[model samples]
Target: MNTIEFLLSRRSVSVKLITEPGPDDEALDRILRIATRVPDHGKLTPWRIQVLRKDGQARLGDFLAGRFTARHPDANEKQVAFERDRPQRAPLLLVVTAKVRKQHKIPELEQILSGGAVCHNILLAALAEGWAANWITEWPAYDDEVVRLLGHDPETDRILGFLYLGTAAEAPDERPRPELSDVVSRWPQTA
Candidate 1:
């Protein structure tokens, strides 16, 4: 497909449907390099990508479950297990974080947005690399303990998303996309 066609058809496959055979070390290296080549006004480069696979995923899952159980004593085994298994849902997970530089000429929002761009770029790059990918940020992304566990300073840093990349077990159906009229606009008004 051409560049425009590729962009128009780009969509995420479900994480549950994402199986093993994720990008190899070399492919991941290429994806990461391509993912970071996004717009940065001041070139702050505030984004970070943490790869979690196999042992790393298991450890993170256990820690997240423990934290969840500690916070909610009434949570049953099933509830805690959900958190525990989240990280292992896919063969590979990339924790995209933003270390916002405050008190700088670069606006905090801009720095944070740079990280957001990195998140999307990752998805695009993964797809380009012939891998199924999705970007997700559930409750854990906002949890301070989770950030701390990942060795990031929650005070100044934010978890943009957890990018899951792997081979697609099955093809996902295309969903409806917003119309240009609904999302696009003109700078100047007519009539």
Candidate 2:
């Protein structure tokens, strides 16, 4: 598809519906390269990508499940299992971390936004490569323990998103979007 068509039709496929046959080593390299091509004020590439393969996903799931059980002593087996399976939903997971630098010319907010842009770019690049991708920041993204488990310094880094990448089990239907007329407006009225 062309750029315009791709931009208009692009939609996130659910992590649960994302199957195997995700991008391989070379494809992932290209995707990562594309993902970093975002607006970074001061050129301080204040972000990083951590890839979680099948084994890594399993380990993360186990860690989360253990943490959940510890935090919620009354949790049932089902709840623990749910936590354990969270990261296993996709074949590959990309953890986007925003390493905000202090005392830099660029504002912290802008650095964080750059991280967000990185997430979006990853999604678009994966889609362009005919792969289904979804960007999610669930409870783990906010959980310090989980962040540490992923080897990220929760103090200096924020988890921008957990991008799930794989083949779509089936094409996703488009959801409702804001109407341009309702959302767009020109500043400084001419009338």
Candidate 3:
């Protein structure tokens, strides 16, 4: 599909069976490069991508569970279960971190906007490649322990979102979007 068609047709695919999601190195690199071509003001690429594949995914889950357990020694069994199983939702999880650098010319907010644009581009690229992609971050996103375990300096790097990528076993249902007239506004005054 062309650029405009791809943008309009792209939709998030959830409930992916994901039997195999190991994109080849060449394809993966192309996707990463496309994902990074977002609007970056001041040329500050204030973001980083972490790919948790195979053994790494399991290790990350263990690290998070351990930290969660340590943080709340009095936590119930359900909380522990949630923490442990959170990482298994997807076969491959890509963590996007917004590394806000202290630059005199650019504000932290703009850096954050750039990181958000990166996440959107990733989803778009995945869709264009006929792969299923979903961006998500639940309780772990806000947890200090999780951030520390993920090797992010919370004071500088913020968790933009975790991208879950794979192939879908079932087609997803598309929902209706708001009409342009409902959202768009004209600049000049009309009678």
Candidate 4:
């Protein structure tokens, strides 16, 4: 597909529906390289990614499960298992973090937005690499403990997204989008 066609057709496959045969080592490296090719204000490179392979996924799952149980003592085994299996839902997971530099001249908001751009770029790269991709910032993103366990200082870092990459078990349907008229506005040119 051409660039415009690809951009228009790109859709995030559901993480729950993502299956196996994800990007290989070379493909992953290429994806990572492409994912970082985003606008970084002040050239701060404020984003970081943690590739969670099998063992890392397992460890994260265990931590999430324990956290879930602590938060909901009455949660059933199925619920606990759901929390435990979130990371393993996709064949490969990436934790995109906004590592903001408070002392830098760049605004903190800009740094965070740069990290968000990285998350989007990661999804685009994975999709271009023939992998179904989804960017999610579920409960774990807001949990300080989870962030700390991921080896990041929650004070200076925040989880931007959790990118899930894998083969799609089923094609995703296009969802409804906002009308351009409703979303777009013209700012009158100043004299």
- Candidate whose lDDT is highest: 2
Question: Candidate 2: misplaced stretches above 4 Å?
Answer: none
Tell me each candidate's TM-score: 0.97, 0.96, 0.87, 0.97
Per residue, candidate 2 scores C-alpha lDDT tens digits across 51-135 of 9999999999999999999999999999999999999898899999999998888999999999999999999999999999999
lDDT of 4 by residue, 1-191 (tens): 98899998999999878999788889999999988998898999998999988899999999999999999999999999999999999889999999999988899999999999999989999998789999999999999999999989988899999999999999998999889989987788445
How many clashes show up per model? 0, 0, 0, 0
Candidate 3: Cα lDDT at 190: 88
Q: What lDDT does model 3 reach?
A: 0.80
lDDT for each residue of candidate 3 in 1-191, tens digit (9 for 90 to 100): 68998787778877345536645677677779998999888998999998888677777777777778898899888888777766766666788889998864889899989999888888888778888888887767787767778898877778888888878767778889999999998889587
Backbone clashes in model 2, listed as residue pairs: none
Candidate 1 C-alpha lDDT tens digits along 89-130: 889999999998889899999988989999999999999778
List candidate 4 segments past 4 Å from native. Answer: 189-191
**Model 1 Cα displacement at 58 (Å)?**
0.7
lDDT agreement with native, every candidate: 0.92, 0.94, 0.80, 0.92
